[model samples]
Target: MGKAMFEKEKVCFSFRLIDMGNGSQVIDESIKTPMDALTPELQAEYMEVHEQLAFMKTIQKNNRRETERGRKLVRNPLHRLACFCGLA
Candidate 1:
């Protein structure tokens, strides 16, 4: 990972967390391996936005699938009319 180039208030923030695999959720020590410099706040914001976008994409995909299923379905005239209303 490339280091963060931007500096805030003349302070270059670098944060890294490592998991010890001891069934602990929180990381005790800082980054041992060299990683890209990134501010904790910036990384958190990036992750939050990334997760929100992923969730929105998932919802859109599901809605598209539902609409496609509605369109693909073929039945009697009454059923078709009912489904047409559902598509709207």
Candidate 2:
């Protein structure tokens, strides 16, 4: 008979949950923006703006995905509301 390897490895997590009454979600601290450190040099300032813009683009993309997912979840209720209120 072969010995079973059932040893469990240690895992760590720092999850945080936030509720907004209607729904709840997990928060990730890594998404937070860093402190601004702009310099007087025009090129450096432009580069900083470019970097911030790229970061914003990434965040906006993520928001679009999340919003789509949320809309999917609430589609039934929203559609019913639209029909009931004659807004559709």
Candidate 3:
């Protein structure tokens, strides 16, 4: 599955599954920022959250069969964030 988020004319974020050519797949994430648009503090915070998401993706990838707990834990935070942002 894939998803893309847009802001104005730009794609702010996206992710998709990529075939690695070795009978494996990987999740690829793309995060984009407008030049000089974000304040230093905001940029730092964004990167921190991005790192956390990356770590979570890694965990999910390493565990071939996702446990119910793992699935819920990974999804709940994102669901809450979406709801908080009025997107859910």
RMSD in angstroms between candidate 2 and the native structure over all alpha carbons:
17.7
Summarize candidate 3's per-residue lDDT along 23-71 as a digit string, tens digits: 8755566635552566778557556656777898899877755676677
- Lowest lDDT sum, 10 consecutive residues, model 1, at 26-35
RMSD per model, one decimal: 11.9, 17.7, 20.1
Estimated TM-score for each candidate: 0.44, 0.38, 0.36
lDDT of 3 at 29: 65
Clash totals, every prediction = 0, 0, 0
Q: Please identify model 2 stretches exceeding 4 Å from their true place.
A: 1-40, 76-88
Candidate ranking under lDDT, highest first, comes to: 3, 2, 1
Error at 38, model 2, angstroms: 16
> What is candidate 2's CA lDDT for residue 55?
95
lDDT of 1 by residue, 1-88 (tens): 3355554334322323444678643322342322235467756754564566579889999999998877766645777788689952
The stretch of ten residues in a row with the least summed lDDT in candidate 3 is 8-17
Candidate 2 local lDDT, residue 59: 100
